[model samples]
Target: MNAPAASSHLLPAVAPRPVPQVLLDALSARFGPKQYSVAQAVREQHGRDESSFDVPPPVAVVFAESTEDVADAVRLAAAHAVPVIPFGSGSSLEGHLLAVQGGISLDVSRMNRLLRLDADDLTVTVQPGLTRKQLNEQIKDSGLFFPIDPGADASLGGMVATRASGTNAVRYGTMRENVLALEVVTASGETLRTGTRARKSSAGYDLTRLIVGSEGTLAVVTEVTLRLYPLPEAVSAAVCSFPSIEAAVRTTIQTIQMGVPIARCELIDVNTVRMVNRHSNLTLPESPMLLMEFHGSPTGVAEQAGTVQEIAADHGGKGFEWATTPEERTRLWTARHNAYFAAVQSRPGCRAVATDTCVPISRLADCLLDSVQEADASGIPYFLVGHVGDGNFHFGYLIDPNSAEERATAEALSDALVARALALEGTCTGEHGIGLHKMGFLVDEAGAGGVEMMRTLKRALDPLNILNPGKIFVL
Candidate 1:
């Protein structure tokens, strides 16, 4: 069967750039037969991500074990002007890993290592391939932990590339704030360092911020130095169910406005609560729910919870359950993190077209309620979840991949939702970067002139246009 037509937000079909045999031979010689793979399985694995797009896989996969390995592989790809798509844990949702202009998939999962740790400064430097869970596990005993959790146990490199934020972002901020430094492999195969371990700098260019959310278009991040946080003395997790999403959202807005330092405030609508209940084996109240966490001294946490409980009470929130034990807290959060998978499993053989939009705290209710009404009217099976404390949320519209009609309907819903977000002075994407899925929305969010400015930077850094080509606005 012919593939479904590209959505208005997706890149049109493009021929994959030819990968010359010499480049493959060179890579094989350098990395050996085991490390360099032309096998279909490896290429297929590296070629796609959680996105709905079905673009062809890259020509080959090159496993890089070190920064030297990444630099060498990139240099070889540069020599032939071949697109080099960096592969992390393969959890990105925006088709970021697709090889639209086929070349090589540079797998950095083997480069996983903790390079440096400075508990005194609350900073640590790690290789790009190290996952967030692994990093936290390694540093758990140090009294310091990295708090940027983007749903997936994503690689630090991938998290840095996408400027990801998650449940903890309501207080700790996203990668843009936490990522202090980077060692990047430039398009020309040269290694370059940006930022420093210092908390703040008045240095030139601020290349660290530039590369943090560049989506691998500017360069491949080899190492990331991140700001860490000390584990809180007392931590508490709680869930409160509301009669409606509006009630839950209003409570959240009030909490944030009243200056409550909520570590995580996530919203799971009734449908998603049911899915999570089934998937995670929990008997959560099947209603619009807020999963929240508080971090501080025991008294401080109690005070914060009491204030929020009163606010929730005003909004008709009830069944405020607390999971104070570590195991219970883990189970609740694990279910929250597994929401996407739970949703996916709820509908077998379906592809999800997820929408990520964030509005101002005051405008969230307006933006979200209208979108919810439209989604309910559309008759698509979906799950609603959000880091609502910061005005960001996602709706995963599950559709049968084989049905062109379903794909078009899902795209229409996403497009209208994005237009609504932009109209409310919000971004089309809060965390998921502009990969193949949101090219048009990028132009809508950042005007043509702004996009051109991005293209200018892309050209200057990657003149050959070989680094993750056809992403973050066509260059």
Candidate 2:
């Protein structure tokens, strides 16, 4: 496979230049030698993300230890007109951390601290560096859990920055719904706090939302206040195999329409099942499958499972197996979360060109069927998995990263899928924000007028355009 022709759709090719000596001296003095680095290895590590876009690394990396450190780093970068990009777990799949225009990468993974935990209010405040799994482990004794599990143990700040959601999003909602307030460091390095611990507010401009999905294009997030939920009293997992993809999708549609209240309803095509079987050492039917979980009181969970089982049987679902123990449930979901790795490892030296398109439940069957057909026809090795309960799914195209033809074929398939999703009044991206990969799709999703309004807001907030330049849009 060969790479596609260069276009404005990607970050414009920019030559890397050395960081100014004066700015380097100042940053080194402020952060100390332990925190600041101009080493090639450090720069290279900070420049890339989990996405497929190839970009040059930043000139320097700063491992910030506190909110004051972030403020100072941004302030110094602003004074020198250097681009500053925030770094978290680097698990983002949209090239959000790519240093398209060379400058510095400010790492916040060291600011891991749990500031406050209010079990009474069902809320917690913490530094941005804490990962989701760590947060849950800390609060598990209280019988409370944070539900935004993106499957990567990703940083809370990174999750907030991407406005991410995962398996539980169908029941618990995304970061936009869970995050109540934020402490941010602006373009000029001034501290700004948006919202509060209050559940809801009519306060002013709703800056928290504006910054939530900005992808570091507007400001750097330092702390996040999150909403938590009590652990469910009853939980159970089940997997059902279907005769065909449509039958599986129909089961999901009908389940949602019937109001089953399933906590997690995932769809895995036959090809994906094969990969998981190989990667996770599972022996089950090699057919289209739906992995589901029910949460509530014992009777309620039983009732929900009964309702879904009936719907699945109507669609020719069989081999219903329930994971009634904690260990069993964890093993099932861990395999599901490892689907991406399984798909990639299925083909040696292959990278995943993944697509996430969400449609209304009414149109899911059409959109997903067409996409699966297109991917199959492309003759590219691929896998399909979806959070079908919320009408969102992914198609992972496995291709040789250095082969332009393979890249082009994968991208063409992704473009066709996005077009189909848009035609059906769906979104181009469900969770991943508009980073370097999908900037072109933004204008199509949000009309020219709408995009212009976004640019205007960007300018109003960061007049210097020194904050994560060459992202979202090329202002």
Candidate 3:
């Protein structure tokens, strides 16, 4: 959907609430003292995320080792009318982990088990705590792999909660497309199963999709069934340098328009290239560049690379670097994945306020170039990178976290970029789900009617508002 202009600012400050002693005692009794913690440090650690939004930590943290544990935590939270926030790897760029309403953090990281792996069916069922990397490692011998990579080794549960997509999304699609089924715990602690192992289903309301991107506001996902892909017969990686951001983006648009089955097409601006060079210990040319990957038979990969090389040359692209060996391929993509940290370390002690705007493929050039120009004009230390094949990109604006003026400047630039993207019929956030930071923008993206309908569903499923309250929308 084309997101409307972002209208909301930062989340309104919420006062902290005390956890009822009786509820805490009950929790301790139910799950032993070791499974639950109310220590100050633990609560503080669970309260923040990779984002800048700050809120007090949950009054307690419960380590859930099984689906029944999750259900029980939710049931207890509901009984006390307290909020329940699900915790994963804590790598979320938005404040999806913040305990805004003061409740218990039901951490599922302990439930990291690969329950079922059906190689013939190309499907796998896993408990919520397993990270994508771990899952890939365990399944590597099966000749299959999970393709949705959000750069960070994020947990599957967290990825589902945010509806994450990564560099591979140009070909593999996002979590919204890849997740086959879900086991979720409702606000009232009911275990609800959505979808089946079958590839297609007209079973009912697509509750799987509904809970996939709910940001843990609707239900806490306990288990996930994922679609897997066979390891490609042949893989090739390439890097092409362009004269300018516009040229690189134009090349991307034309490649997609020509229906090239490029697996990964990423745009790294000159500044980001410089950062990656320093961070990754590779001396790549400092210019706007596109790093890409192709998967197929040897002949197919060669044909695809030749086609993209011609397209790149037409746009004045230089230096078509290819990685032939497995080690080379890993090094190349690892550098690309570390772009975020590279951008962060570029400015010592500066926190990054990033933008996530995606425009239609046709308008990608205009939208990207305009946003880059704005970031340049702001004089904020920033880095740019994009999944250009899909018309999605990001700008990491580095600023002093303590300086309110700098923070506001970065936010203003982000807001302006979102406004421009919306005007171009794009979305305010393409991959990063709306947590605390983009709650206001949700209204613009989803009209009053759409949001009200969502509210109606939330009320129907969670009458007590116990699941991740004050997240996607105010209740």
Candidate 4:
């Protein structure tokens, strides 16, 4: 399956703005040749991300090592009215990193450094370029870890931009809840700080959160202060096989309603389980399964697991497998994290049109089952997985990009799924932001008046429309 061409109508009709030679020369002189690059390889690398959209690469890449460097680059770009797309780890699944309107990619990977760590206060401030895994490793010695893990080893800036949530979201919440403060570079190249280390405040605008999920359309994030958690004293993981996806989902709904406080509760349908088994070399039961984790005191962990096991049994869940050792737990999660890759590999030369819809926990089963039926009937190969505890799930519709019919079918399936989610009072995207794919859906979800308000805010902050132009919405 070859990658399909993205619909031109879905993208804004904005031509790539040319990068003037004088602007390039100034950037090269300001940052030195080593940090400024126009090499085809560098620009191409910074252009696309995990998204399937095939847009042209940026004309140049600026490797900014400090907040001042970012300010300078933005200042130069502002002068030229060239779009500036902030680049982090480039792991965003949406078209967040695409240089739709050509300009310079402000690469901030060089700005990764731990600026401050308040171990006692359970807070840490770091450069935006730091990856979540790197943040955990650096703070592990202090017995604290960041909980927002969006599967990919995504940079903190990227995660914040997407307001990412993962398996742990049921317990720890998303970036919207974990983030404390932000140091952002405005469209005019001025530094603005929001939020504080204190737990909460009756601040004026809550600008920290405004930038948390703005998708780089509002401003560029340079520094982030995040809330951290102390490692649990007791931890255990388990996998339970179910007769059907409904059973697994019902078990999860019951567990959450009962207030189990499960650290992680994920659902992988039988098809996805097979893919994981083949990819990870583990013979998990080739059935709908729930992979769960519990964290607390030893007694509390045991109690929670017992309650969940009982709920699973009531729903015909059996073959409960336990992974207590750290090695065993890691193996289980690594396989779960690799589910997307496994599904993609299952269909050679295929691109996945992944769907992210989240509803209230009570409505999870309805939203998932109906979508599953539609997908199965469409005859498109897909994999189903969800953080069911929080009513968020993804369906990866694998399609041959060369087949226009297949692409349309997959997209139709996605459209139906989003409509269903909305009818059930859910969102079109659970974690992924409205980059290039879901612009219309954002309108559908947020309504015309709400989207207009967002546009108002965008015009107020970035009147020049030079920051990540042609994203979130059309000007």
**Winner by TM-score:** 1
* Deviating ranges (above 4 Å) for candidate 2: 1-9, 13-18
348-423 per-residue lDDT for model 4 (tens digits)? 9998887788999999989999999988988999999888889999988999989988888888888788878888
Q: Mark the 10 consecutive residues where model 1 has the least summed lDDT.
A: 1-10
lDDT of 2 by residue, 165-246 (tens): 9888888999999999999999999998999999999979899999998999889999999999999999999999999999
User: TM-score, each model?
Assistant: 0.98, 0.97, 0.97, 0.97
Write down the TM-score for model 1. Answer: 0.98
Candidate 3, residues 21-43, lDDT tens digits: the string is 99999899999977999999988
> What's the lDDT for residue 289 in model 1?
94
Model 3: lowest-lDDT 10 consecutive positions: 1-10
Candidate 1 residue 355 Cα shift, in angstroms, is 1.5
| Alpha-carbon deviation at 354 in model 3, angstroms | 1.8
Off by over 4 Å in 3: 1-7
Candidate rank order under TM-score = 1, 3, 4, 2
- Model 1 stretches astray by more than 4 angstroms: 1-7
Which model scores highest in lDDT?
1
